[model samples]
Target chain A: MSQERDTRTAFMEATYRALCTHGYADLTMQDIADETDKSKAALHYHFDGKDDLFREFLAYLHEGFAETIADHPEGTPVERLVALVRRVLDPVDDSADQQFNTAFMEIKAQAPYREGYREVLRRFDADLRTEVADLVREAIENGQYDEETDPEEIAEHVLTYIHGTWTRAAAVGADVVAMREHLVDDLLDLLVDGASVPVDVDATEDRGLAAADPDEPHENSSEDVVDPR
Target chain B: MSQERDTRTAFMEATYRALCTHGYADLTMQDIADETDKSKAALHYHFDGKDDLFREFLAYLHEGFAETIADHPEGTPVERLVALVRRVLDPVDDSADQQFNTAFMEIKAQAPYREGYREVLRRFDADLRTEVADLVREAIENGQYDEETDPEEIAEHVLTYIHGTWTRAAAVGADVVAMREHLVDDLLDLLVDGASVPVDVDATEDRGLAAADPDEPHENSSEDVVDPR
Candidate 1:
């Protein structure tokens, strides 16, 4: 069982590398194989096919996200919320990271079509929403936020902003790190009581927001999707 | 030339019908042709292939959006902004509209891989941003909004919200029409001066936000993607 788990981890990492390199539209078992020591035959042995592999891959990612939330550092609800946002929106400076994000967006775009993918993404969305809602409730209970603040509504808006920021970042290379500050400030101003929450985010550190041209086409040098045909 | 333009319009409409029926992932030239009076060979005569047709389709959609903005009802900047938001987030209750939205999102997800799609989407984003920014500027000029309000920043945030809202609406069937109220309220509370810009929105009308289970998976009675392979 332990050996099987290690094999799956290796395959998941391999799949991630492959997706970053080739993207969803063009990714193949062969590409995944190139990222791993395992042969294409080995991949076939592990999964039914590409779709099956992708479904499991999304589940893996979803699990990872849930785990990250679970293992968040203990802090005041406000701090924990800020930390969560920061962690999720941490700047995508490296080409590999950007490529991976692009690929992930591609998969998300297909969620409407693939039930397996849609299920995983749905669960991911629900879990995140619950986490954010719980935190908001905690903050409200602790008297950090305004008494009238609706935790579910706040969570919904926060998730919307997060989703929007991420989509724009992946689709058009929008400056999210800059947007992150705006999001944090907006939440604090809207929810926090007067002179209660300290703005602890560092605005000085530029997180590669200026690196990419906002108007440039999505086809960057690092992440070009080859035509599978 | 007029005849040629009519023929192109027919094809574009045909493509739209096909996309509404068969999503981007499974869409084929034949499927598009099936929607038109024209044969598959006729579709080939007009364009190189599926990608070329899709590129033109996106351009067509972008142009239609621009025209829609131009044709917006004459109102104050605040009213116009609200109108625009209302129009875009117009209660997507009908299954046909829902299917079309899902298909459109699938195409957007593939934007990273397709330069033609990316270009069209980028132009769409820029045009929307400029329009929102200009409205915000006009509101500031008219003393409807705070003088301290940065139009560009407001536009960016608005676009992000729009993008995010669309994504969540498409991805998880989130209550957008309900969220729409929150968005309008947020803008008014944050930007508009006290009792200056009237909350002109009709909040009483239920626009299908209460129709769907927010936690339900995306696969519904409508909008199932058929795998071509």
Candidate 2:
């Protein structure tokens, strides 16, 4: 039994590597077999087909995330939540993990018609929201946050931040690790400080005029405006 | 010359409809031709191929966005920014536009190998940041906001929030319009009131204990957490 479980684990690892190196659009079972040095028949025997393989892969990802959050050290709920975000955005040297994530998203985009894929993605998203919400509620209860705090709203915000950061980072080729660090810091800042302020009318007017005529091309006005990081 | 332009316009309109019904992944030039009721020869005569069609579509999208921004009524910078975000979140109900945006993201995920796609996407992202930053700076200069404000950082944060919100909304089938309204309100709150506060310790302890063990599933203890929306 142990040996059978080991083979399945080894297959999943190889499959993940292959999916990363060669995108889901291009991946084939033969490639997985070669990567794992297992017979194609052996792969078929363990999993029904490519879809099955992907389903299992997603399961592994969710399980891993749950395990990581479960093992986080005892600390302020905010600290623990930050740690969770870091783990999700953890640095990876190879493009495999990154590619894997992108591929997962692509598959998700097709989920309206792909019921199985949709189910898996929904569950994963729910799991993330629930866990984050729990942490936020705990923080509020412990008086780490204001008494009137809303956990669901905050959880949604954090989840949105994570998704947005991942999409933008992937889009721009920015260092994922650095981007994740910056995001966590900003999120923490927002949660603690809360949003309420006086509007800056003059600044608002200037920006309004600038974007007024998108066709009127303006020279890059300020060097400092560029993202230094 | 007028006839040629009209034909081009017609082709673009037809192509847009087809794209909305069928995503970019399933899109083909032949389908575009069929949708537009133009012969394949006509399409070939006007543009190179699938890649060419996509390129032209992107150019149109950028122009459309610029035009929309330019045409918006004069308003406070925050109001204008809010308007821009609204426009982006609301799908035009035009097939071509939806397909184009979807394809744009799909291509973005695979951008490492597509120089043309990367070039356009980079400029688009940079422009969004610059536009927002300029607005924030102008607001500060006009004394609408505190002098200690960092317009660039705030701009990036706002842009990130928008992008993240839209992506998740698309993934989960959320009402884009409703989400946009909520987002604008939340963002305004955050901007007016900055994020910074002391940590809550007691809430931290309860959350830590609950999340400490993955093997032990805890019953859902908190029912007070409700969706803010």
Candidate 3:
């Protein structure tokens, strides 16, 4: 890598460490500098100030997120979606990742206030929805989903579930681990008819009904219907 | 009401007005005092400080939310659940309420950082889930829903949708009014089988399918069948 690019990467890495230690509210450039081999003066040369550096950090995180999504491409749309969520939801015992998740929530909480954050967040949300919508399209093409399903709304549904999980994580004592175990299967059932995961509902309700009506098709999710408005 | 209680209520109302103006980050006691006819000294006399006053404001809001839920009991569980969402989503174009929603989101964003906000938020979320779970219980008892469905998970699904809507509203350019029109029927279909609403889904997918599968019975959502976890 170029020397300039290497320095920038190191700066962000130091900032991540400092952010994990002091959190967003108490994070300081000096702390980040101390976390790295770079002197405080060296840190000041790359960015204008704290907000500028933080904005760059957010950009870095967004790029990383997109790369993670691109790197995992080994399964069907439903399996891929579930795997993506599981990867995020079932992180190993990594305190840094947990701290990063907490800090990310703090940053997201600012999306309404900061223009930079808003643009990045809007794009991120839109990108996620687009990916899910594409998956829905694939499912429909494969005859696993109903032709009448509104891909955008299905996309929104998945995004909403993910957002809700984030919301609960922000709350005290949210059992993300337990919810992770159930959410993916629930989502699969919610999205594609007869596509079963390991959830209990599959055994009693979905499989039972699948047996009863062998030719029943996928559900249209009600959002695909006419609009009285 | 007693004079003391009236004073506290007036103080909370004034705080709400001030918060809507300055937001949570920059709010000051002087700003709140200016919003009320009461002097700053009188405000200080009632509460120890800003944190104390803000805690009371949250409590007031929580109480108001509880009252709002209790006051609206016009329909069946599914209908009542849909109506509750509609009421929150389809407010009249009152800028004050809109501003209040924005301000409420700001305070909610602070819950992770502030103990007072965290407690209030936890209670509010728990209460909402409890109410929905009780409604789900009623649906089962009345034969409107499947007997084997897990009320807690069903409740979580609805609350997650609402929470996700709140998250989206915190973003810029969120078209909540447009979403409110469709989400109610979408939610109904996910939770209960064969229940129709005013949404065009009633005319298209739902009612059409209700007519098609006259004996298809209720969908227990597959995830409800077995809980290995």
Q: Candidate 3: global Cα-lDDT?
A: 0.61
lDDT at position B148, candidate 1: 61
**Docking category for candidate 2?**
incorrect
B1-229, model 1: which lDDT tens digit per residue? 6988999999999999888888777789999899988899999999999889989999999998887555555566766776666666666778778778778877876776676788888888888888878987888787677666677777777788888887787777777777665566455543342433334332222121111223221122112111111
Clashes of 3: 8
Segments of candidate 3 deviating more than 4 angstroms: A39-41, A91-99, A190-204, A207-229, B39-41, B90-102, B190-199, B203-229
As a whole number from 0 to 100, the lDDT of residue A3 in candidate 3 is 96
Candidate 2 lDDT over residue span B62-119, tens digit each: 6666665444434555445555555556643554544445555566566655546656
**Highest-scoring model, TM-score:** 1
Best by DockQ: 1
In candidate 2, residue B13 scores what lDDT?
Answer: 77
lDDT of 3 by residue, A81-180 (tens): 5555565455325666556656666666556566587777776677777776787677667655566666776666566666666667665446665555
Q: Count of backbone clashes for each model?
A: 0, 22, 8
Tell me the deviation in Å of residue A143 in model 2.
Answer: 2.4
Best by the lDDT measure = 1
